[model samples]
Target: MNTRPAGQDYIATLDLLRLAAALAVVLFHYFFRGAAAEGFLAECYPLAAPFALYGYLGVNLFFLISGFVIAWSAESRSWDQFAIARFVRLYPGFLFCMTITFAIVVLAGSPLLSASFSQYAANLSMFAPAFGQPFMDGVYWSIVLELVFYGWVTLALFTGLFQKRKLELIFVWLTISALNEFFLGSGAARLLFITEFGPFFAAGVLVHHIHAHGRSLPALLLLAAAFLISCGTLSVTRHWMQNHYGIAVSSANLVVANVVMHAALIGAVLLRHRVRPSALILALGGLTYPLYLLHQNIGYLAINAATPVVGKWFAAVGCVALMLFVSWAIWRSCERPAQRLLRIWLGRAVDIGLARFRRVSTEAQPAE
Candidate 1:
């Protein structure tokens, strides 16, 4: 059912789902990955590690949601508008959170976590690794992937391909993704086309197509293809976990988790009518971006600092609560205002540029 709430273009349920995915990632980092033999944590939570190990899948969930959301967002705007909207949405929050993380790491950084002026400067571009600098926070790697995805979407919109030949485009994209991931194993292709994670993103786009335009045979088939490809790509994550922690996540569990995540996306779209949109729901969704951006390294520092006095469980829980509050504050106090200002400035600049280009074209044309 494509019944969105009146006067709203977005599905409110998706916001809640985003927050849930963010929390899962936070827990995964805190309870499982942080405690590995060479992990960041000073203490381990053996009990929670088993369940939290699966939490890394939350990033996969975020990609799926982003595909649906980006497609929905691009549908109603011109290419420049889409670009501005995405920039204003992502950059302000990223800057604020990145700066906060930088300051924290500089002032109170442990050997495990620290920052330099060059690194911070590189991070300002939002693609730090290209400049031979590491991300100030490890979580920024995902943000870079997101930026690459947005770059592709912006290009598609510019060429009118996204609007006119979206399904065909997705087919080619999925095909390339399968080839590189399953056979070629080219790291460049993996980075450029996002081969490893493209299926999750493509699945999201197909889901949006079904939600908005109604499910057709072709769309359904492509979506099924996406699901199968996604299951295969889970091997990438399994391999990483094995190499890093020497733990193997079974293929069966990975497939089951992937299935459940895809199912959840479908269910959210179908039952969207049941979620009533409210300011609180919007805020929860808003906070998730900053929460995801700020949670990892800063959280490690916080947990390590607090664990001795308050104990490990309280330290972990308290750090989460603190991060949530900080993220909410950033969303409300920083991101909203900065976005409003950037939207105004960027909108006017784009309008002026487009007007000049039109004038030049008009003057260059012969009188009819």
Candidate 2:
């Protein structure tokens, strides 16, 4: 979504996208949480299961946003500055969230305590991906992709490639994706680094770049095509079809479908920004992070707590609302303060390092 000029600071369409992704994830987790069908509510309804199947697509949208936001967030910066900013922005909030999740698990009779120290250490460092093992905490696997992208962005910035050869770098990444997914037959690897999703992110960057360069309809159309192809490829996975429609489709065709749909959706949203963001839309979008993290487990927890009274749908809604409220409070109280402190500290540390480097260089200079 295009960032509007300053003073407005509002883009209704992106908020809508965020809200839609959050809902997709919430619905996905609602059915897939535990006990398979979640009893009759899912089994009888049948509609809920499809949501669960498609829910994983939320991650793709996120990758797209990350690509756009990273560039958007750091449009004017030195490499050190951008890296420092990204670190400060992500780590403090992440650590706090991790700690919160840890506390909850311990209270909920965590099996983790019985695990070996090596196992515990692996989790603490977010090492599940390296082991090709699933994690105890459900949301963590997604972070692996985000972190990889962060590393990629940092490397690009350090080499001045982000500034100098941006388009070339994007092409190189797309080539790697095609090679890995098709030639190498490494679907898992393609999914991991979000190599397959790179085009979506590239589209986001292109959105901003084109807007900055003055908009052109033809350029946007090409971007739309790229987005469609990328998303289509992802949608046709065997797991997605079986779980969603109970009918398997060839991945080759699924890829094409995903690409077409993603492009169309993004284009529609981008073109429809004249509409204002309603309060409800903002509320839903605001819940996205908490929904992403807590949807699965919270639904289970809610079902257990409200067993006598609340049913599945009620439990799902209540869990989503409760998690959203809790997350909002945490964001305000903990996340904000932590981020502010991190920024100050990171900036000061960078300044000190620069000063020390200058001092050393001055001492090494020939007498003048």
Candidate 3:
């Protein structure tokens, strides 16, 4: 059996890092109930506050990794091929999870669920809650953003914008981000999908380019600066209309910071080879999607069930543990198997298309 230990190289190392990030998110929720201002849930946990605070960063880490990994996947393929691959990779898991979540909500008789069949249909299609209303799955928002990024990448590829000049692309996005930071408030600065994140995504693309170009002193310095800025460790303050603009820069700044840190972390993992303890990390990655989807609802249920029996801390812990266990089981069973099935189905469709094309070509030819 060619079970092939999955992550054996730099790419694998990034996968391991992704798993670690997922675990950080899990631990963050487990301890702090997803609230940053709150301290540890219990006296036994000292690291909870820092960990929970960084949980939001974990999602950005996934986005940064997604951009880098998608660039890596799309490198050798044409736009159409890349789009199909991305669709197959993302949609199947997403749809399945959404359905399961909606069903669970319905079964649980949550008042938040749609009252009618059409409303349920809308939720299932992922287009519901279009006007600031949260969707059936709280985690679906990020999925939507990811889909937008995928569409943007596809458009860039078709327009020849992604053909060459990787760093130039990154710089262009950075400029947009900076300029947007300067002009528009943080709210409007977020319109950078067309204007900004391209660079961050391009930075991921630049990761491939940097390897080809070879690292230089200047490049290293720039990367270091970008890293510092993204991590919010760089102490630079500029005025933004009475606000000190310390933590509250442009939305573009926060986005850029996230992408930069993400790229740096992925790059570092790829560059280094040493493996640390990863059981929890691996488990977290496997369960992240489900946990993210189910955590809030499950946590609520858990609190309701346990608040009467024990204190909030004990109840929260038990709930989180139960959620984790259920998510892990789903990942092992439904999620992994469903993904495999979808891949197979998509592969067969591609094969059929190719076979039909060949047949049409053969019939059209004259006697040869």
What are the lDDT scores of the predictions, listed in order? 0.90, 0.60, 0.56
Q: Pick the candidate with the highest TM-score.
A: 1
lDDT score for residue 355 of model 1: 100
Best by lDDT: 1
Q: What is the per-residue lDDT of model 2 for residues 1-368, given as tens digits with 9 covering 90 to 100?
A: 11222233355666567656666666666655343433313322255654465565666676666565566655666777777776665555556665555556556523322223344345656555466544545767676676667678778888888888766676667667656755775767676556666677767666666655556665566566556547544743566547854555457655654564456445634665676767665555544554565455545555556645776567666766777787666656776687679888989999999999999999999997
Judge candidate 1 at residue 22 and give its lDDT.
95
TM-score of 2: 0.78
- Residues 1-368 of candidate 1 have per-residue lDDT tens digits of 01122234667889988998999999999999887865688989988899998889999999999888888888878889888888888899999999999999999885888799999999999999999999988888888888889899999999999999999999999999999989999999999999999999999999999988998999999999999999999999899889878996799999999999999999989989899889998889989999999999999889999999999999999999999999999999999999889989999999999999999999999999
Which TM-score value belongs to model 1?
A: 0.96
Tens digits of per-residue lDDT, candidate 3, 234-337, equal 11221231153122334555556566566565565466556553656455556766766666554554455576789767776787778778878877787778
TM values, all candidates: 0.96, 0.78, 0.70
Q: Where in model 2 is the C-alpha error above 4 Å?
A: 1-12, 33-47, 109-136, 186-193, 215-225, 228-232, 239-287, 365-368
Of the two candidates 2 and 3, the one with more favorable TM-score, higher being better, is 2
Candidate 1 worst ten-residue window by lDDT: 1-10
Candidate 3 residue 109 Cα shift, in angstroms, is 5.8
1 or 2, greater by lDDT: 1
Better of 1 and 2 by TM-score: 1
Distance (Å) between predicted and true CA of 274, model 1? 0.8
